[model samples]
Target: MLPHCIGVYACGMGGAGMALATDATKIASNPALGGRLGNELSVSLGWMHPDRTMDAQGPTPPGFPFPFANTASGEQTSQIENYPDGALAFNYRLSPTLAVGAAMVPGGGGETKYAMSRTATGQMGFGNAGAMYDSQVRIRYASLTPTVAWTPSAKASYGASVILGYMDFKSNMAVMNPAFTGLPSSPTLMTSGANELERVYGIGLKVGGVWDLSPQVSVAATASTGTRYQRLDDYRDLFTGPLHLPPNFGVGVTFRASPSTDIVADVQYQMWEAVEAIGGEQPAQGGFGWENQPIFALGVQHRLSDRFAVRAGWNYGPSPIPDDVVFANALFPAVIEHHFTAGATYAISDRWEVSGSAYFAPKVTQTDPGTGDMFSQFGGGTVITMKQYGGQVGLRWKF
Candidate 1:
């Protein structure tokens, strides 16, 4: 999953600032907060780096035609990638109690590239037909959200947004046919065969609200119907079903502990099982077998003085891939579950500010439940591990 918070303010707070209107970036998180900002603009840029590796040991069945010599015992490390992330947002008050806003930000996606060694016959144990082949997959998403918010009373604000999204996807990996028997009549080993980048467009909706419970407490919630895109004709035989983004819902609360200090907490749930290509049965169905996931975030911000503030936070979630499905998920090892973040903001003037934030996720590893049955598809002595680090810098202007 991609980092949900594209702006430095929210990233510094571990993505828990959705309930409060701190900056124009709120338009992407909870549009209701836009009404609270009279006029604001924000822009940010960042990079993400992930470290991933895979190790496997294979067994040659007594009666098999090709013994997959390259899979005997080997370890492959994924190449490091510095993926870029950025966002721009603006909010304008159309009336005393009405506001319009827009934001361009990343939705969610991942990338992986693994180098493999070929055998004497120009075929690898992984079943790729090319010599010295590398298994790789990259998927990216960008979204533009236009929102309208209304505040009829001092107690609450409501908003709605329309999401226009685009996706770029490509994959070059080996896949086994369900009925493979290593016999002459069995289906031959197949791969995606260096497909070109494919593009798709989709639309979705989001609605949210923020309510003040008292002078020092407030709560907010937001939900989105994930985008549905056109079919990837080039990948018809590579995947079980068309790929679609997953839906999500989140809630957050903010409390003022002191005049210069505030604390925030949030919970978000992703419905991966609702997507056909992501939550399908197994390898036979060409799905990832990913389970629904829930994430938690907590943050604290303290104003050191009139011109400076500091923030720190923590975020956590359980891995969505079950142990039984580890074999199939090797191509996408999104196993990191813990994140630690810190950041600071400096007000250069009454109407200008600069903010920066950084975060790191510790390494996590998972091993497959190897049963020596390759045809079962799930059993293989494969281990996958991943870790991540990233940071962002931004400038915000208020008019």
Candidate 2:
């Protein structure tokens, strides 16, 4: 079974105060907000679901070196109908200048399905060619952060926080083919599973200033640096080889568009070069060579009345997987381009609130036709495509 742990949400306008300063949530954003806390506590919960689809195609040439070869064309389709996820976070104020919090979020995960059947014609006698592959993955992470901030002056503040967490991942793969009944065909049937949990620990430091350019406008900036993590061995099998988690950084701006509305924009960088697989121990075979990536997000919040608010956001990043790693398993294609989100918050009472958000990632599909030595062995060629979708809901309580 896939891990049921939901991933964490980035620090966005829908959360607490610092959420207005930056959109980077996987890590701590504004520690100074902790200093403003009264003796109250806040708790939140959220849910998400992602759908995915894939397709592949190619041609089988006559007299090919492999079984099931004959000048014929073939195609395959695979999809993960529905995937579910959830998360929770809690924060409490220790004192006027100190706060502590914990959160659980989805780190990374995917699911896939593949099914194909083809008939060939020519001297090759490629009567029927078919293959089926299915795989699914789930990753969950929980973090504890203790924050401290000092407001030396009303307009200047400095804060620090440490992130300590553990990541749990589970995955399953199954493949079947009828063409391999003869001599030694490719493993006509195969199945495998990996469930490993790892720990991640790091520290972050932030410094910022609020300069009053005038009564109507103010400018602020913050900077930070943190440590990397080493994942578990079972999770490593999903990658090409041994891998490490890299450190990351971010910056953002908040603009007061009106007395009751604000606009925020942020740029974040993730060190994915350290990741090796979907969910397994250290990378196993040839390295996939993923690199550090950047993510951009923009959000706006408007206060319509005293107890209601509206929000919308957008995020984008590049694909982390390379094209040449031909493993041909249908777990994760990693070809998403952008995420669009919209959410709202309503006050149920003076100390309770309810919120929900939806994120849509346009499906990214790719088809790779087998070629060279591999082409002659698998009949003719292979094609592959992928797509995805995600959504979430949450509740917050303050006391």
Candidate 3:
């Protein structure tokens, strides 16, 4: 899945401000913050570049006659390198303690494209050999949320939003045709084939609350149900059921360390294990065998002057895919575990400001034990390594 910090201010703080109202972007992290932002609009654009490589080695699986003479031992780079991200948000006050807002936020998805298919059945083996059918998969998601925030009392606020989500999915898998293995034909093991991308939509709900314990401290919590998407009938063979996003929840605390400085900490959980399409064991359900994931983030922001401020933070989340399923998850490796971020904002005038943020994630590598299972996607003994860098810039106007 994509990183959670897609907004300019959120990215700057390593996604830690669930209890503070920064701007219209607050609609994303915690709709309850909408009532805190008077009147504002925010627009942002970002660039993300991730470098990934796959290394495969083999003593081929038992009884596997076709050893892929050309692809048996080699390293290949993923063709999918760059991605564009952006967000838009607007909030308007409806009453002394009521607010209404809307936002276009980034949901999470993953994509990968490999030049040479991993299957051993190339031209030299069985199937026609031209460019060695490419194996690729792409999935994307975005949500439009209409929210309402209510502050019935001085110390607490509540909010809710209707999550209208859209998704596009595509997959082109290359596998050994079971027809050649004296077994019944299986769509999951068929030769490479092209399939049109499918567009699907779904809806979910999100609700949150914020409470002020004291003048200098605040706490907040938010939760959302899974968005159940329409089934991708076109590639039913590659997936056991519709691809629905997993449910998630988060809690955060904001501490006003001093008048000029603030510290924020957040903890989040993703219930991937509850979603059949994402958490089920591989081969049996065509799933990635992902476990539940927990993420922790910490950020600090200090005002340097009346018109300038700077922030930095750290974010960490362990990979959800277990070592036993590495081969099955090669195409969608979500192994990034640590992120370092920094950003600054400058006021152009009383009504407008510009902000920019950048992040760096050091490289991480994972290799699967060579079990050599015939049903595994990449065959065992596959090593995947990845690292990423990205930045976002934005303009905010307070009227």
The lDDT leader among the candidates is 3
lDDT of 1 by residue, 1-399 (tens): 757465888889888876788888888888899877878899999988888877653445566555333364366777757888778999999898999999999987888776653121113423443444335678888889999999998989999889898988887655554566655433324445354799888898989999999979989999988777777777766666667777889999999999898899989888888887877466556777788889898989999999999999988888988766766667688788999999899999999999999999999998777542342232356678889899999999999
Query: Which stretches in model 2 have alpha-carbon errors above 4 Å?
Result: 1-33, 36-44, 57-64, 67-79, 113-142, 170-245, 276-285, 322-330, 369-387
**TM-score leaderboard ranking:** 3, 1, 2
Per-residue alpha-carbon lDDT of candidate 3 for residues 215-324, written as tens digits (9 for 90 to 100): 99999999989677888877676666777888889999999999989899999998988777778555545676888899998998889998999999889988887766
Q: How many backbone clashes can be found in candidate 2?
A: 26
* TM agreement with the true structure for every prediction: 0.92, 0.67, 0.92
Overlapping backbone residue pairs in candidate 1 total: 0
Q: What TM-score should be assigned to candidate 2?
A: 0.67
Q: What is the C-alpha RMSD of each candidate to the true structure, in Å?
A: 2.7, 7.3, 2.6
lDDT at 180, model 1: 68
List the lowest-lDDT window of 10 residues for candidate 3: 183-192
Q: Which ten residues in a row have the lowest lDDT in candidate 1?
A: 117-126
Which scores greater on TM-score, model 1 or model 2? 1
Q: Which candidate comes out best when scored by TM-score?
A: 3
